[model samples]
Target: MNVLLVGCGRMGGAMARGWNGAHRVLVFDPMAAELPDGAERVDSLDAVEVEGELAVVLAVKPQVFPSIGETLRPLAAQGALFVSIMAGITLTGLGDALGSGRVVRTMPNTPAAIGQGITAAVAGRDVRMGDLATVNGLLEPTGQVVWIDDEAQIDAVTAVSGSGPAYFFRFTEALAKAGAQAGLPPALSMQLARATFTGAAALAGADPAELAELRRQVTSPGGTTAAGIAEMDLNHAIDVIVQAVVDAAAARSRELAG
Candidate 1:
């Protein structure tokens, strides 16, 4: 398959790097940055003169979509499948701008840079089964891919998976700080925090129940874990943290919609 990436910024560059061996890739970025050894780099869309059986990946900022949209309208009309990685832009919004029916809007997190990201995508009204198959093939190199039927759910997915990593990182930082306050050396505290969260995440992945159940199994009356749980549970700290994150992200998603 032939793939053309419109922007070679962080996300686009990551996708190019990850998908290198899977397809014939061409990158169109004005900066003239280095790409994978065998990948073709075109300075601009005008420099890209060939077209046929192409999958166009749009990694440009949402603000630039209008101008780029006009430029890409012809390509879309010519039968190229459009896949957008811009956040907050709905499939309907993209379809209106690109004048194409075969559009897929994807919300991919920064972890995609390391081939460990999770992406949630929703197809536009004009997307066909073959188009979706092509998209799945193109995204296979990035990480796990999920297709959602409802476009509205993309915002919630964005909140949960897209912003989820940063939340964990913050928790890790707090864990390290707490450990230091409790008397562990700073370096040791950080190391333990990292290891503990990593192991817990792995365990959670292996288990199918709610995380609260896992916590219960590890807690015993009059134990250190129980005391810590008591402190954490006081005044519904966990619920407040979860609601704060989800609400902030969902509101941001709505703001981006405009």
Candidate 2:
């Protein structure tokens, strides 16, 4: 597949790296200093050339769309499948801006840089099965791909999986701080906290058990794990905090769409 990737920033660069030897990728980002092997850099959108089907992956910032949306419309008119990974950019908005309804809106986390991210995608009104299949093929190299029927769910997906990585990182930082407060060396506390979280995530992925069940397995009736879990759950503090975080993110997503 031939791809035109816009804005080779962190996420765009990650996608470019994943697609590098697999597909012909043309990237347009004057600010990008370097690109992965097998990905060619284009000076401008007009410089892009394709013989067959083209997949234009938009990984630019949501705020940057307005400036380049017109420039991308020509490609969209040529039947290029548009896949947007920009946060809060709705399918309808993209379709309107690009003058093509064959658009896919996706939310991918930072782990995509390592080919372990989970992406949630929703098709625009005019997207056909073949277009979706092409998108799946293009995105598979980065990580897991989940297709959803309604675009409305994208905000929640963004709040959950899209912003989810930072949440885990923050929790790990907090855990390390707590460890330090309990007298462990700061560096050692951070090392343990980071490794423990990553190891637990690996176990979660390897095991088919439900997350709650997995937690239960580590929390004995009167064990240290149980005590920690109990304290965290006091007055449903963790639950409330998580809910608030997701709600705030989702709300901001809606605001961005407007």
**Quick one: best TM-score, which candidate?**
2
lDDT tens digits, residues 49-164, model 1? 55468889999888877777878887787788899999878887888888887999898888887777889989988888889889887777678899999988887888899899
Candidate lDDT values, in order: 0.85, 0.90
Question: Can you list the residue pairs that collide in candidate 1?
Answer: none
Cα RMSD to native, each candidate? Answer: 2.0, 1.2
In terms of lDDT, the poorest run of 10 residues in model 2 is 13-22
List, residue by residue over 1-258, the lDDT tens digit for candidate 2: 899999888878877877877789999989988887889989989878899989999988889998999988889889989999898778888988999999999998889878899999999988888998898888887799999988889889989999999999999999999999999999999999999999999999999999999999989999999999999899999999999999999999888887
Model 2 — TM-score against the truth?
0.96
